[model samples]
Target: MYLYFEFAKPKMKKKPNKNTHKIHNYEYYTSGRYIDYISRPSAVYIQNDNENRTTLLAEMDSKKLNVNLFMKSKLLINQLSEKHIDGYGFKEESKKLEGKTGLHKLFEKNLIDIDPKEAKEEFKKLENNNQFIWEITLNPGQLGIDNQMVDKNEWNEILNKHMKSLLKANKLDPNKIEGYWALHSNSKYPHIHLGFFEKETNHSNNYRQSGKFSSKSVERFKYLFENSIKTQAEYQNLFSLKNSIWNNRKEIKELFLSTIALKNKQETKSYEALSANELKILNASKVIANFYKNSKSKSYAAAKNNLEVKEAINDIYEAIVENNQKLALAVTKYKQEFESINKAKFSDKYSAGLKDEFVANEKDEFEKQIGNIIVKQCLKMNAKEKEVQTSLNYQEKDLKQDFNDDELPIGLSFYPYKYDEISKLKRMIRSLNYEFNRLSRSQKFQALRKYKKNISGVKSKVIL
Candidate 1:
């Protein structure tokens, strides 16, 4: 139920009135969880041309609204059509229904009361569609121009490139995917909201499907948003006359037709039983994959399953793990390369030089960007090594506290189960410690801003 709507009234040539031409907003979503109201909010706006026509005034990103999916539930996107848009909806809607009504209305209702001293509970009740879910948000003014976002001027070419590449890969028809352009400037920083329809409907909005949209029901909701912005932008002339994005229809269409991460036929592989040799090959491949993922040692992983042919599998695995000591050294080397940049760049004195270098050299810029990925791999390898070392340490400790079952496999302990039970204590300790660290980090980062605010307040007061 994560949704974002931002309005940008033209800041350049055309400015619209925020006062005279007001926007009526409606919102929809299922609510749960206490996301920081100040931190998390989605905005979409309506553009309006002022009566004076001189200022071309508008209220861009003036307000934000948040919706949650657990307690306070909101839905009703399929409701908007030409016949019934409800111009005077909110006042009448609440009288019509008691709780949050539509998408835009949820924003207005949320803004009514605020207790800055505490975080308010917007969630009315908890509902379950439980799984590991994550979300990201962007305000028009706040969203940075990069590869992650479609930069306005650079967007056309980027979109076109993606379209051409995808078309060559999938052999898709441009007409099958429809594209529309809209500039909603009724908000702070002017932004263009381009909508692309897949034309093909997804079967599992009911949940349990691979290759889903950015949001669970992102496509449908985005369309409703797109149409709303289109109507509003056209009425207000939020688009620029000189630098209009209107003419790039061909490029825009290509972007719309580009590959979507979501699809109906998610799994394209055939289902069949594997033979004995095939199974062994699969197992070897799986082990190598897991080792690479867990070890971060590409050398170890590559040697394990370097060649795909049947004869080479064993030889490859042996070659890869030929000597564990050598493999470990290679891992250390790679790990050092990964950390050398960041740890150096972030240091107090050296950081200034690193920053200056970054400004001057594209190589430094590229390295800084990818350095985290290298470090992440190194950390994963270290974690795997720690796990193995911890396991070995526990086994040695267990041997000392042997059980009474002397009749079993060689050094049979006094009791088999007793030895096993005592041995796991170290592992349990490590597991608990790992969880504690993760939770502590989460709490600290989330509240860091609030702590700074308090510190600033204390410093500013007159202490005569």
Candidate 2:
């Protein structure tokens, strides 16, 4: 699943000098929900700092992660890959049992597929539910433009107006389907995640509605949702700049692996008994790293392309990779940086300072391994892409093709700066998402075994 993270951080700013009575200009970091973690408990699932992770782990239970949906999907997909699932593709399989109790029954007949819990299922059963799920998040210590202290209640009202407008413009029926909005007041932003349900089937599993769901249909929903995001009054400010998204499963999988590697490194570097402040830094860093990785993978095909920012991010990333020296320099720079940031005397700087101070700290070869590691990891693209790029570079030097129209450049370079800020946010969000999913999908579940028949690494036993 594609994950989203916040790339921007709020910096110190002055409100219009009304009576010259000013408030504290605080710097803050933020994050967004990952696609997979939709079912995970929102409170802790969205939390990223190590201190909170430790605190939440102590305060929460294993039951809270609720990753059964993810587990079942994995197992079923693996099983079908090995054997043609009921000798039918997913579309035909669904068509076969169109009128009957299809979803849970299909799971029973051909390994189970998970239906999300009561709340999500109930929410989805509403008429045009997918079209009306009003989701918005806020950053910590943020406020509205003096519209009478816009706390969660006030935010709810603002969102309500937008929802009503959307419902009207789209010719939605409020009478037929009951809609409700709930504020997740306990969260950092204390934001809202609302859903409207068809009053008729809101109480039960509506299999027929799900019968209409498919990957292609979901893509359509995504297209509509994105357009709605841009036009919706409440969301316009929040999603003013369209965030980057990765569509291909293979590319997304590589991004997941890359995130895992970065998270491991951050955890290793983190000190014992991390304070909330320190943990927040960790969270911010991970999010920045994540945005950089995901935004760079888009092909030229998607209409929602963010190529300008993508290329800029790539150039910064390439400065570290594509060579042994540049990568090593960055690693060494950050190593000294890791120690320096903790010092009490050093003035606090934002991301640019954070990165510049990193590179400014060193000259010795003896302390450059960490820089090399970071640089090397930066180029971890898909194998096929890497091979193609490498071959193209070699061919460029080996044989010159001279027609102006037919000329091709060696390969695109990488950049780390444009979105490194966002990658930090993505890292923390992914870490929380992964940890939560892992907790719920652990091997002990009975449903897991029903599905593991598909994923177990079995060989053909070809006797050579």
Candidate 3:
């Protein structure tokens, strides 16, 4: 089970008012665990075989203390130091056992720094020095935790490392704060109780007004404790999975770069010379062009929402993957490793469903990355095609200008013919015009008369 945590401030009471209610003013000094446990006794005390356990009957029979104790620090320390609390006073493997004499002192922090008598006097001197209390509970039967797996030293170390993080998360200054914690070893669930307050009271508004630790602080500590108790083998498995994911990402990135390079290489080639995969990419580019024309945003997210754009992207992605065997192998290996680790660790139906959901999320992220790459490549190709078309249009305009120039004959004009035929026609027309201009007036007349005589001769022969 996951770690459970709860927080609270000292009990508060409403100020006396006849007409309107005022805010409840919290007390600075109160008995800590004894007051809480007596009010709500939830857990059953189970006696273990090896150790001399404290009987629940003794707790019920003990005289109760006044609810409103004036000396809060002394009462709090005495309650925390109680010997009958399970896992608090006794060492685990000690053979010298008795009813309650063999119990060890509870492990404590920062409390020993201040004398209880002096702390109680100091508490009385302050007006608004309220403290916050919280507890962390864990079940020993959980998969990653057990009685032997964690000890006082480990808990102390983990808490010490994250204490500052917790304080900062809750907007408290670590330097100004003083705190204490004690771990109680119940047979079913071991838990720790902690409380903290400012050493010298400051009337600053930066402190949390909610009087409770933030959820961020709770989650941070939970993660810290969970990671601390993880076994070496679990760490190795997690490291291997992360390495596989890194390799998979690298392979995908390389595949995208290579595809872009290939497109650039084939940009100048004629349509007939392109291979099947290249042709498919070219068609995909046109689809992407239309997508950009109609869509407001050219982002991959918007592209994937359109059916035509989605299919085009998938087709291009599949084509590239088919041709790149390394990428295919890397992706397959990553998925297999992920599933293998998850299955080995979690075998129940609910865990299986969670694993499936994780895999789907990973797949969606990968597809989004690949889709963005495809869109970029297609846009590049479309730009190159437009550039080539613009160049051809300019050349055609120049050719039309040459044919319609005033130096040429009036009947000569531009025609949509092959380059060679157009060049030959221009040459023939120029030559005939040059010869006609070079002839003198009388010589031109003589040539015209000769042309008419030849036409008349042909007509007479036909009549005959």
Candidate 4:
């Protein structure tokens, strides 16, 4: 799951600024004073002015500063670069524009070919008004990303790969795309700030014309990033867990089918004939029947929308989980492994809230899958039941028609033995009709022919 993944909306300006000023602003805010202000322990500073030199130092004399004034002073000084006597300001070393303390070097597709400072100047020289600035923030601690896991080189590679992907997603040629990114580490939550524009502007591209990045593009980037970061083992575990959940769902469906079959059997038997296990299945089938009766719509989407139907589905799902030990165990294991992976990637120390959100999201997805399976199975059973009922109705109609014969011997009642024989033949014909109705269509034609021939012989014998 993603840990505190944030894609800031792409910044667009109605009136473009000077390229020099834009590049400077992007660099200064993304990797310079912005980082210093957020990472600094305190805003309080003291100015030491003497004949020799003037230096700004972090204040050591806490007793001399008012806490309330310090906060208000910090708030008043919006720009961290601004000089302040009692609020946050860049230190002497931090003031150097070339210093890397708060400034991360810019990187591109080929790291060796581009010098960080020179790239900034080159980007400034680009004559494009359609340039876009994008920002992505990833909490390292939460993402289980430490320096050891992803070094600077690997991070640059990952960024480069995703940059190409992003360009292609926007319908721009990757080969012609020019972009630079800086991975800022000064803040607790490390982030990447990227600036890019097509070298040869493609006005035909919808993204360029609209000047908006699609949400699909952002989500794709996140997916790519997450996959790239996961270890092979982690990936395998996730794959296995997914398959297990699917298998469990299938098992639940089979259980429902078995219970449905048991219910059909019970319908044809007396209560005393049902064994304990059969009775249990019969009771379970009744619960399913109740769900169908109460549901206004058999559609899974509709069922989810209706609170009552949703609750009934959940209740049935929970009961199945509870009763089937293997299914219950598999479900428990899946949740545990899922939560474990989440915690490993997004440590609780940095992303407790995000971790919880991801876990809940996974749970919702699982339940939706199970719910869909149940709805489909139930609908299938309902269709089969209707089919069986229709066949019975047809059989009853055939029975009535077969019995209404216009050509019966007129004096059959006068001969008592002949009347009894004719009555026996009628009963035999009824039995043959029942057996024929049960036969397959292929077998039914032949069975009907045989029954007709037998009936004709019986009628002739009785008449004689």
Query: Measured by TM-score, how close is model 3 to the native structure?
Result: 0.39
Residue 171 lDDT in model 2?
41
Q: Give me the runs in candidate 2 sitting further than 4 Å from their true place.
A: 1-118, 124-141, 145-151, 185-188, 197-464
How well is each residue in 287-382 modelled by candidate 1, as lDDT tens digits? 334445645445422332222211223422232323244443443443343334324332233434543453344333332222222233334444
lDDT of 4 at 7: 20
Candidate 4 local lDDT, 1-464, one digit each (tens): 33222121225323323322333344443343333432232321111122101011123124343332322233212234556564334555234322222223333433332334554555455323344433344433445232222233445666677757866787767776655544444333344445554556566543345435667886788777655655422433344455554565465556655544454454555444655554443343334545667667655555443343454455556655566676567667666666564665532223445445655566666666667765665566566777977987787667656553345455333222234666656656755743453344326535655666667544211000
Q: Which lDDT tens digits does candidate 2 get at residues 251-356?
A: 3234434543654455333333555443443333332334445554332222012222223233333332333353444444443444443242322234334434
Provide TM-scores for the models: 0.16, 0.18, 0.39, 0.31
Highest TM-score, which number? 3
- Positional deviation of residue 314's Cα in model 3 after best superposition, in angstroms: 1.1
- lDDT per residue, candidate 3, 1-464, as tens digits? 35544444455443432211322233323333222331121221112233211222122225342211211211223333446545644454233222212111122432122233333343343344455533344432353333133234444555666667777787767777655444443333444444455665446644345656777767777776665545322433344455566567667778667867875795366445667886666666676776786777777887643555666677777677667787677656766766665565533445445556655566667677777878877777788778977987888798886675465556554543444555657567755644453344236546655776667544211000
| lDDT of residue 98 for candidate 1 | 32
The all-Cα superposition gives candidate 4 an RMSD in Å to the true structure of 23.6
Q: Could you arrange the candidates by lDDT from highest to lowest?
A: 3, 4, 2, 1
* Segments of candidate 1 deviating more than 4 angstroms: 1-34, 37-211, 214-230, 236-464
Look at candidate 2 and tell me the lDDT of residue 12: 28
Worst 10 residues of 4 by lDDT: 48-57
